[model samples]
Target: MQGNQLRTFMATEQLSTFNPVTLQLPCGMLRGQRLGDVQRFLGVPFAEPPIGDFRFKAPQALADWTGIREANSFARAAIQSPRPPTLVPDDPGYSEDCLYLNVWAPIAPGPHPVYVWIHGGANMAGTTAQPVFDGTSFARRGVVFVSIAYRLGILGFVDVSGLLGEAYRGSGNNGLRDQIAALEWVKHNIAAVGGDPDRVTLGGESAGGKNVISLLTAPGAQGLFHRAICQSGGGQTYADQLMAEDLAQRVRIHLGGESARADALLEATPEQLLAAQASLVDSYPAKSPFRAVVDGVVLEQAPLASIANGAGRDIPLLLGWNKDEAGFYGASANGDGGVVQQELANMSLSEFDQILIRYPEMFPHLKAEALRFKALTAESYGVPTLRIAEARARIGRPAYVYRFDLPPEQGAFRGLCVHTSELPLVFGNVQLPTAEAIGPVEPAAQRMSGIMHSLWIDFITAQPILSDATTIWPVYELGARQVAILDEELRIKSDPDAGERMAWTTWQPVAAE
Candidate 1:
């Protein structure tokens, strides 16, 4: 197509005042679209397509190209199972060759802090194409926002190193390695788009949040990002080598009975692999089979353990979870039934009894299942979030903890600030169509969005987190246990749930780091 037609197409597609601009970076020249003050470079290949020979392997850096590549449209999302009704895919399709990143930057020049986002889906789903993750608000606030897509499910997290031999040594961590590679690309290329490479903040939610914590312990990921924001993700769920291999064995069996060889994984179609993964996941509904493995090379130690031992101690952290994290699973068909119970089964019987006994005393008004919901919410998210914060506090590092208290005023998730409720608020996309599916905008939502979004921007910009004149966000402390309670009105609370906190003190939820 001619240059004029290309410009017209971008303008029409973006549905905004589009000024086609070309940027020359280390890898290649990219033609991006500019709407008003924000310049967006979508579908930018940070690495070569992880397909064919690179399939199920770590990502490779993109080689230099001679001509300008059109980065106007988003690339296909990573191949995975279908999303629930709440999630809307940003891309038109899904494919194995989905190693791409999107950048939203201000038109102004000079260095700006960067916020690199990694989407979460239990290491099985999600894409950078989601509308809720759009970086326009962040860009308008003078922060360059970049979101990336990595391999998922069996293709990304299944450990085949033990069966396929040494070539795929970090096979289980392929998605993480992809993230590291993207950071490396950012380190060398972000300045061309008015972003400071040294001031990059890595952030994510759910599985993406887990990856942020995982990357904190990854040797290759060191110095790639300077700060992190982990939402509703803890460092307790990683699989050791043996466990990863065991899960891989199950996947192999589902791929093709007992006789299937490891080599056959190379020839199986994406559809067949996804089908087998579905079966494997169904077989173990309670377990997260495919996640980061504690391979000595890629991830030397568990994230929580490493953080406790001063790993990434210099990096400031802003992390938290929603108050009703388990409500999304319970009473909602969004996930498997009994997941809350399955997750809590890891606790000792005595510890379980202690929590069970406290439920009635702590919440006298709640019923049995409602009480269980509160217990699971605290055990699953609150415990781990505080654990990481305590680790940081113990080391005299900066850490800000928060709990999202306000539930959506509309939708099926009304009155429940369930898992992933903060995405639209943090991204300041609460009015977007996809966000509407999550929850409609309420009267106080705009103010809440400003409060949450501004706090994130303050962190990314390394400015003081002044949410409002009266509210002062404090660093987490071992004594005070101060937590920012985010809602229609921002307030600080000390030991919000003292009862639950006291109960979990006798029982350690995760293994020692």
Candidate 2:
């Protein structure tokens, strides 16, 4: 393992050039590869492949390796529903063995803050492999960026705790476990990749936003990430244990069996389970089928109640939702606009009356469809987010809040300030399908992109948000209600919608009722 032979081994494997990409990890040596100025280590396993008996289990740490492990390509995405063609590469693969993470670091050294990104797809579909989530920009800006792929759909979110006993109690949240494993890898090995483990930031959008919030309160995920950014996600989206158990039972029966035995389910293929799970979900329209659960272990309680009780109070959280989160969110496998329509139709006499009376005046000019979509967005995404901010504020923990009020170009997706509109801006990948569909990217939008990206990098790097005096953005305050507005002009403002905030404070969802 000395001089000449070692040098030959490293060179042949694409480890490094004049500047080698070899990093000594607790697990083993990871010979690096490059993509331009950024050194990338992809397909690195944080956990053992969750296949076979490991299918319904928490992620197990990867076994130690002997020589340089290949990290030049991405691992398969979690086996789940298909992703939008626009969001995926040409030959995107799928697998149950999908607990891999990718790292991007500058070619030069000295530790930098690490940004851990989790993709969003209503907790059902998404991959770190998306072009929009590439970490090259963050790396170039002196931050080590890592994106991870985790379990989804039936494999990740099915709760069999009650039926299967203690062995599989944490099965419902294997995806969260996968994320924690990735964080654990960061804590242990990010230093080798020019990252400061102590300065890790967790960020996500949409369903990924929900994951960030969950990790904030997640016992296993504590102390793993220092800061968090939750975009257009934060609601107590967890299904109660009874509900999850019931759904699991239905899924088993739909697979042509009434047996509630673990062995029975173990025999079924992932495709069979996913198909049956989807069938069972079609009946329960308004709720996300594959979601987190209060398993009394990994997650002690639901997000709202848990965080309100001061869980993750010490972690700095930044949150906001899009101007229009509904229509542009695409169809969630759990619940879509059609399901919302059905639920609205079935509301009780009193509930229906209340909405009919209040909504029109509240959103005066919105058409029927727009009104429904906006209401759902607020209830599902916006209101819960504000509630999270309030929860933190009540506990004497200040959280940064923003309202993405930027409008898109006219005739491009009809200029809707829709869900995920800020993604390209944040990632500095402005050539997305959404951007094209929304027409030309304006100069103001481009400026906003730089500002937003800089602010994000600044927070992660533990630096001041700006180099100026006038734009000193303050953390949100309950009394003064200050928030950053990201749009044509970046400025501070009071709570964006006072009336809507008040409505949700008193309004509970139908399930809670």
> In terms of lDDT, which candidate is strongest?
1
* C-alpha lDDT (0 to 100) for residue 164 of candidate 1: 87
lDDT to native, each model: 0.83, 0.76
TM-score of each: 0.93, 0.89
In model 2, the clashing pairs are: 16-20, 412-438
lDDT of 2 by residue, 211-269 (tens): 89989988999899999999988856876678678767876787766764655667888
User: What local lDDT does model 1 show for residue 487?
Assistant: 83
- On the 0 to 100 scale, the lDDT of residue 42 in model 2 is 82
Model number with the top TM-score: 1
RMSD of each: 4.6, 6.9
Instruction: State the number of backbone clashes in model 1.
Output: 2
Query: Which residue pairs collide, candidate 1?
Result: 120-208, 305-513
